[model samples]
Target: MTEMVKGYNFAFIDEYAKREIRRKVLKAVSIPGYQVPFGSRELPIARGWGTGGLQITLSLIGQKDILKIIDQGSDDSVNAVNIKRFIEATTGVFITSDTLKATIIQTRHRIPEEELGDDQILVLQVPYPEPLRIVEPEEKETRRMHAEMDYAKIWVFLYENIVKWKEITIGARYPVMVAGRYIMDPSPIPRYDVPRLNNARTLYLFGAGREKRIYAVPPFTEVKPLEFEDHRFRIENFKGKACELCASTDTFLDEIILDDKRMYTCSDTSFCKKRGNNPRVLKYIDRNQQ
Candidate 1:
């Protein structure tokens, strides 16, 4: 574990603020997909960048907790790197890029390819909290819809997409019905990550600082992506495509153009290295503990 920076609290935020966030989190988990409002405290970072997810991480994190931060599945991205550095300096918690090694994983726009264990907690940074915003612009009306379980507007939106595009045109941030009650935007994670949210062992938490909403999908909870009988929801097909580096066929691949040719690579770079039997990533350990 890194030493906590001087003059800062264990997790940077005051105890009272952490307690309040914890209370909100409890309510969020209990309700399952209900967007519980909280006092989203201003962090050193900008609000839209990841203040929501960072607040939750700081609030729930412990000295012993091992953390992993990823942006769009890349560990070394600018956003991920900066957040990891900030968290490490503030909390003195151990950081790992290896998905399985992290007790709490904070991610923006992607879920790791590896299955998180029951002990793991996944904190997702949410830019938008309302799935009904596309259909209904008003918050009062959206809340009413959620209260009444009225999702007809969203259903129609999907239907219209199918009619116009011959398929559900939503590329990312696909809406899902959690526990058959509330429709939720599962961050901006790709359609490939949608099905992984259903009945997962790990608890999923969503925080939107700009929106001041925190929601959750507890382990084993039902999370069904919105679909129609005729136009069933499907994941992005990468048939005959494999990650160039890892030769992985199952994981989510990011398309890139190199030398005027299309190439696909694993989005989760650490996982890709692991697949290639690279010890560079796996060698990252809690040096203090070791």
Candidate 2:
């Protein structure tokens, strides 16, 4: 067997990739909600494991900034923990559990419960940022179509979803009105996090590495969720169950599989640990350790 290493790898990504990402981030910060093209490089982390988020974090993180990463809104989740560990190893910057203390938050799937201020920046990992992806699969066609503001196809698509499903089949990643013209994707932050976007003081940025696109929402930017007069934009139904750990009725809960029975449960063990400190997460930790 190989001997144990003395320290962690200093290379999460190369300098060239970090510089390219930094350039894209600068453009994104300058032009809100505009998709800027960048030459994205391959990283050690896989595509689905928040590589985009990690890129943004590496580019933006200074020695002064405190970073917080959460997957499904839990800092202790394996994905979140892994990302956090990677950053901590590379940058040696602070890692925070408190939302308010974090200068930058890298999130997947769910947004934090705490309201972010103007000082904070949120970096979202987007699997697919295009709202018209379902309607128009061709990248070349969609780019030209977006340039012309030809979203007639998207409206028809939504209309058809209603016609067939009786309701919009989109669970998360619901489309939103940006600057009263562009219909943008809120990066799958759950519909609950969509409302938090409107007129918020924080800068929201979206990154999709595989798609090679980055977009932004400026502070106090106009963000209106897509809705009909008869059918309003709503969050995923939890069926009136509080978080098993935090007893929070307001936050989103992850669906659990227990003995083939479905149940809604909180996946944020950090949040749960703050409350009565649920034992399930602890048990999971113990099992993993063993």
Q: Which candidate leads in lDDT?
A: 1
Q: List the residue pairs that clash in candidate 2.
A: none
Q: Write the per-residue lDDT of candidate 1 for residues 113-141, one digit (tens) a residue.
A: 88788899999999999999999999999
Error of 1 at 234 (Å): 1.0
lDDT of model 2 at residue 151? 84
Off by over 4 Å in 1: 1-4, 278-290
lDDT of 1 at 108: 98
Q: lDDT scores for all predictions?
A: 0.92, 0.77
